[model samples]
Target: MTEERPVRWLDEAEMAAWRSYVVATLRLRQRLHRELTDRHDVSLTDYEVLVCLEMQDAYRMRMSELAVLMGSTKSRLSHQVGRLEGAGLVRRGRDPEDKRGVITELTDEGLALLATAAPTHVEGVREHLIDLLSPQEQATIAAAFERVLEHLSEAES
Candidate 1:
């Protein structure tokens, strides 16, 4: 049997830093989600899917690729795409190279909706985030998150 190692509990300073990051991250996402819902009748999840598609070539991506980009489960992303498709904001089609695969593309309606929603989203982000930080603080925060992302990507591989 393996011996039990002593726990390395967080000290007061570390706890404070961790708690601050947790609160800030949750509050940031909550505020953005609420504002998007109230102003655009769109959830943050839907907006993310749209943004992911928008960033792709031809504003289209394979369903599996889109799911990964959105960090959503296939079933959940499929349902979300269904809603967008129903709203005429997106469409699903056969992937030419792979008959069994699906493709998702932003429609003109989706682009137009994003155009209207982008301003509100940006304002929310600024009000809650960017405006609160100096340039150096912003850069530090970005670099820190980049490190976190790199770690996560490494874990995935």
Candidate 2:
């Protein structure tokens, strides 16, 4: 029989740090979402999808690949992509390499929306998160988060 391991409880200081980080991250996400939606009529998730597409070589990527990058389930990405498509911001096409696969590309309208949204998004990020930290502090926080992300990626593998 397999044995269950005991939980590793966090100490007071560690717990406080964890709580602060969680609260800050949650608030940041909420504020960013509000700012983008209020100013640009785009959800934070939608903007992130656009960002991934924008970063691709031809401003397009396969749906499955995008799901992995976005850490989204197949159906979740399908729904999000469908909404973007309905808004005329992006379109889905059959992958030339594999008909079974779908590729998503940003439309001209989508690019224009991104152009409108990026400034507001950047400003919110600066006002709420980035500008509040010193350069060294930002680097340290980023490094710490990278480690956490690496652990998550490894756990999934």
Q: Point to the candidate with the largest TM-score.
A: 2
- Cα lDDT tens digits for candidate 1, 85-148: 9999999999999999999999999999899999999999999999999999999999999999
lDDT of 2 by residue, 1-157 (tens): 9999999999999999999989989989999999999999999999999999999988999999999999999999999999999999999999999999999999999999999999999999999988999999999999998999999999989
Tell me, by lDDT, which candidate is best. Answer: 2
Go through the candidates in order and give each one's C-alpha lDDT: 0.93, 0.96
Residue 78's lDDT within candidate 1 is 95
How many clashes does the backbone of model 2 have?
Answer: 0
In terms of TM-score, how similar is model 1 to the real structure?
Answer: 0.92
What is the Å distance of residue 25 in model 1 from its true position?
A: 1.6
